[model samples]
Target: MLKSILLFSLICLTLLTSKAQSVQWASKVMSFSSEYSDPLLGKEYRAIHILGRPSKYPKFSATPSAWQSLTPDNPGGEFIIVSFDTAKVVKQVAIFENFGAGSITRVDALDENNKLYLLKEFNAGYAQANGQITRIRLANPTSFKVKSIKITMNSLRVSGYSQLDAVVISDGDSPIEDRIKLEVDPNAYLVKENLGTAINSKFNEICPVVSPDGKKLYFTRWKHPDNLGANKNQDIWVSNLKDKKQWEKATLFPAPINNEENNAVCGISPNGKTMLLNNVYGKDGQMEKGVSLSFLLRTGEWSFPKPIRIQNFKNKSEYSEYTLAPNGKVLLMTTEMKDSYGGKDIYVSFLKSDDTWTEPKNIGAAVNTGESESTPFIAPDGQTMYFSSSGHVGYGNNDIFLTRRLDDSWLNWSIPENVGPVVNTNQWDGYFTVSAQGDYAYFSSVENSMGAEDIYRIKIPEKVKPQTLVQVSGQVINQLSKLAIPAKILVKSRVSSDTMQIDYDPYLGDFSFMWPTKKPFYMEIRAKGFVTRRENFDFRDQAKYFESVQLLGLVPIEMNKQYKVPNLSFIQSKSEISKESYPALDEIVLILQENEGLHLLVEGHTDNQGDWDENLKLSLERANQVKSYLISKGISVNRIDTKGWGGTKPLNTSTLEEKRRLNRRVEFSFFVVQ
Candidate 1:
């Protein structure tokens, strides 16, 4: 049994000490009756069912003798108040009558003035004759709007009583079209060639499947011009998108796919790693009544197609096609169901971690109607669903419908709409599959064709469409000298830690990668000659055209040393002269500027070397030599502190030339946060 789980919706709440904002309904009631005579309100009013019982109608028409209200046990007439607000349009209307099939005379939607605006009175099916529920669908009804809906009843030839147990009215809206947008100007390129002959051979052509990186395209061709098989034969063919925009002449996809039997390619994984197609064959080894589902693997040399056993394939007439999610776990399919709305509805089955398929479940009434719905394809994000519906409102035949997944449930599904004059005419418009980037829409259409439905491509506008990726790019460079540096850069998402690493060309010093554009990420770089650096980039807050490039200056580890040198020099005036010591102090200034984190304590010392008081004064003077150079080079004084240790502490306890040299040296250590 399929599990029926109740859904919890995310609700926005506002707290209030007193009774917060809320609605108070006087009461809830459902009124169901079978009679079509008088209008209840204006032309807009059809049948009114108020929340609470109101005063009786001024002139209530006699209830038809054949009409009766239904409850839980009687099987049809239980009407539930799904909502009490005004509705603009009713997409579908369902009713249950007691008399078995062919029991009702007619069902019509009338205005409050008793004028019929729309009607759908079809022959009662087997289920309807036996007191089962019957669903009636109307074409787009935008000509008039109403708050109430009326259902008129008429008995069969032998005028008998008509009973209604429940009435369900569905709110309707038009389905949204696939939107595709170009990142750059459209003048950037044009279709060098359509390569229609690749898949067009005087037979029906369709289902163009493009590879992940936008390199290869796989499509279905029938009665292929290059085939040795009989006429009306079908085969899978592939074409390459060379030089970015040009599609190479298409050819039969490698073996095991272009078999003697009719093989139709349905969809391909974005990565081009797997393909799903359906094949029909019989004992004669040609197109037959028996159609088997299979998958093709791109194992270096394309492997033979393998059959799928998803527990739902029960008959030769049962149809099934695979729609692979970008992540490769969700598989959307179609099959005839005993409990289906009508002929067929799309279903989804998830692949478990153990590699087994789960039981398939209907996409539910939100997307599937009682009429046949099939050809399911999910956008790369796995949030938007696109399919074809014959029962949906459109220009003609099958029209495309799209619905988005919200929270854990799919809701707010737009009604199916015609793709306009370009993609649809009076024929079937389906078997649609789109690229991850949402740039191109490929489907079977009979447009400027040599024969039956030829594969056609349309560009999806960007504003309201889906996208496959977010691009990130930046430069590596020396922080202090402002020079570009080439290094290995790795971008890791804080949540997933999935790393996309790229090495900058030693000369170019630039790197970039296409990161999934929905999260926070950090970039880190490591170089052999410099310090490791890291930067954080939050894509969530970035603009649509965001890009980043950074420069890092690596600090070289300096050695601690002891040295004897000439007395630090002071030039010109007595208070501001240190000419001889300038070169050595300049080197220290460069080091500090290169490594921003570096801080140093400058101490002055005299060679064992002098009178206590006189040495102290001289030591201070030498320390000033280092400080002045740093100040001239933009180094903040707060970062450098000076102290004098005059002749007090000596090195090596010796008075030799070497001892004096050691005692006269300068020293500094690194101070920085980890």
Candidate 2:
């Protein structure tokens, strides 16, 4: 009896599952309201396409030409009301139309009780010149049991007729949740707050870039009265953060940075000292544009913008918009290059050792589609990328999407996910940037706002926030003169050997670098006429967000001058040097090679802990060990001399272990010997 009852229960469960799997389809539309129908073809064309029937003239309809064209009585807006035989829960609707003529701009639906509901409104710029199909997902999935759909078309152009090739309605009653979810959960509260009137104006304000310190906000304001181009071009504007929530009134960037040309701010480095600006101008009767770089001088003035010449950017068609990764090692840009799925796609190029860019590679299909993708912003973590795409299934045209690098390769990426309705609306939404902390995102939107486009800030959802990043920053100065020097800063990943090189501000001596957390890095600071500085950072156990400030001081290369090697280490009490000491020794080898006429004396010292005689012997051996390593690196042995001073010259007399450790060291003194 128990077995019979169990079998009956199993049978009932299978029946219920099968019943749930049954997906219903709406019957063909009984009628449609049209202003003027073709004499040869009736309204049957609309119902036939919705019913998945083949077009009567498949060859001629390649450009979304309809079997019957509906013309409004006058040159204005018109609607086509498509009614179905039975009410169906519509999950999504795909509308096919001609690209060159009047197109559908809005859609509304009527429920079984004749109650109408507005569905979605497309932006004026949403349509392309090529015949294409747009899929509009209903905002409320549960409220889609509608009997009719009204597609409204605004005849903004001279064309009097709006042609509809087909309409497809996807029923949401299917047991499988294959449809793209559009509506946000009721409990999910995400609001996009305007930056307010202080920074936004009646003119267009876009491309917001917040400094890593979160103190300054920079953006581009177009058609402002203060613009140098008679309110026709764009200029960079900046505002300071007040109490974290409010912004001071924005002021136009001064002369050199904002000129008569169309100047716009694209990106700001993590240190807030370097900025990437787009300069658009007309040359030879054609518009020419490129991204220029500028530095913030110590005198609170911006340097003149200089065009960044990428070695591999010979093909102008492939490169459009670009942003530097926080580390400045990689450049993420939009390209219409070959092998792209279609239209403009996001690509990446790495900075090579020769200060040139590598050939750009597409970020892959997971993040791109047959439609256009643009405005890419790589977060400080370096792995997370936010961009805009019309190809992906999104809320509407050019919705913002985020994707993460799955691995070290540019092509390996996670599937792109829409950032959702809080940040993306039905209109054009793009140019998104996030703060270094990953808490708030700043982007331009065309919603109810102060201008045609205004900058807005929204708190990012915790789940969508970027991974943590750590910044390494400081000033590079001359040790003896205590004056700022122009230097090249190189940060290299110990594991991957990937390197990022940035130039320090010559006037300010300030430099900053950002990298994803939990990696070991080696940094080298090099400048002419001075000894280079090298340091290492191990952040495997560091907290999520970390900032390391290091003052890199360089000693001027003078005859008979001695400088302590910062990181040369010896094994406990042995003469053997640690492998971690190689980077420091390599700098010496580089200095010797660069200055062929120089001679070096390697001096080693010990703390005041061991026997005098033994310490002397050990220090001599350690000095010779470093000398031998330099010889192995092709430095002439005759150019180097070694010496040892036991405990006679201790750096620190403190009894603390950490203080005493600093007393044991290796020093290199160089002189010109003709």
Candidate 3:
């Protein structure tokens, strides 16, 4: 069974005096009879996890790192002993059951000097449906000073493992309630700011999707006169970032963008040429139940939004949402399918080779709970994802949290971290968007409102913002003509299998990659009649917030033309290849493998600083190594040749290290083998 959210949250306390005292949570987990095994939270339900405050929702958890029994019963007896730092004369004990509500059968207080006092023995009824705290009222306070509390639970009454998030003991017979507060890192909490009257009216504005380039803001407005639904339903609106500071006056999207139904923007491409809009808008202005795509026409008008196909697409919930990946190859949506974990779980559907969406798959327990998870947005950096979930521990209602995609598998995600209470209120909070800058983030909130849930912005706290990444941007250029060429770039990461393919505008010849600076990556830039140029990029050592600019030059694959290998590097003054250079070499092997008749000569060169004799020998060794490695991959030896020009060839005569590094490279020359 899927271990779910909170059930019973447990805490023990003793009355100090007639004066009302603060509630005390379990300060330490002394021992547990048994524990459940849950790999979803990326951790075990250790007894130590039960110490301190409750970190999950109200429902009983198989885990949110809470203590769950191995079976409903712990053979000898199922119980956990928790202690507080200070002992007090106690009266009432309140148990917080996040999961398996009312499963706790008994409560015992441990006094100083070794006396265990009975608090109350519960009947073990599954009272609450989700997570609820039950209070054990006592007529008289304890006479002795109590330092610890013991909880005994029965798994039989609860169905499965009863999860415990925390236990609270209060003094003076007051009710003990441990409210959840996100622990934002010090100095890492962003101050939320309202977007003001220019964008927000007394109506409603929600679901803000920031453009990848960070210049435009797309959102949904409700009950506004400009809305196409005649102020009856929601419509999509947009605002431009004027001078990088203020947002220009909001304007409702003209026809095709705003329809009679609930219209909104789910995703947008970096160039703002294509958008994944909510629902399919037909020619007659009526809408369907699925998502659609609209293209920006050359005339600066949006084309009609047409429905996109998703195999077996079904949403049980009335509300459905989606966000397109920066590359447009992946899409995330919130829906309830037959296999949904609960009310609404976040699912992913990939854009297939045939242009149809594959069936949506559950993203797993890491992000979804028995509750709802919605309004997903992937930052332009590609890995960081922000969404609102009631399943994870947060303030009341829905709260926005950020989690990163760990690997190529959408299932592997870092534990979702709350975005803090600044922007997330006790009310509904969702629709988070970030740009390539990874600095500022925007969301919608009902508080500090112009009317409805107004749009808000915050300087992303460094702790919760997308990891610092370099925005690799440039245009494809012809090596011979020195002119821009419309091109396509297939970017592959050295560490992840997630390959993002992007196209440069045919007119501008420009493309960009919002790549994490911590990882090494290489890209294949291809255009008609041109040799696919492979360039390696590693900005791992670059400081935070540092973005790089590069010009990718491509050459026509013609006779006697030599193209330099990119991202390939050898250890300083050595012929041995750095492991980082393997991917670049593999690219060459791939090109050759694709063209069976292609033969190649690998030439190695050294910087002018190196001694001629030593550089000559070192360069030759490097070229031979490349050839040998290729042969190991089953390439024919007769089809390969090698040479070295130590300091004899220089891309430039500059003395700076940045420029000097250009001369230290391997170059590829191709010939058609008869």
RMSD of each: 17.9, 14.4, 9.3
lDDT of each: 0.50, 0.68, 0.75
Candidate 3 lDDT score relative to the true structure: 0.75
Q: What clash count does candidate 3 reach?
A: 34
TM-score per prediction, in order, is 0.48, 0.64, 0.67
Lowest summed lDDT across 10 adjacent residues in model 2 is found at 1-10
Ranking by TM-score: 3, 2, 1
Candidate with best lDDT: 3
Error of 2 at 56 (Å): 25
TM-score of 1: 0.48
lDDT of 3 by residue, 3-76 (tens): 22222211123333566465666777777787665443223455655655455644344444467777764545
Candidate 2 lDDT over residue span 38-112, tens digit each:
343222223233332112111113221132335533455656666655677777776655333336678888888
lDDT of 1 by residue, 596-624 (tens): 77666666666655467877776676666
| Positional deviation of residue 542's Cα in model 1 after best superposition, in angstroms | 7.4
Provide backbone clash counts, one per model.
Answer: 30, 0, 34
**In terms of TM-score, how similar is model 2 to the real structure?**
0.64
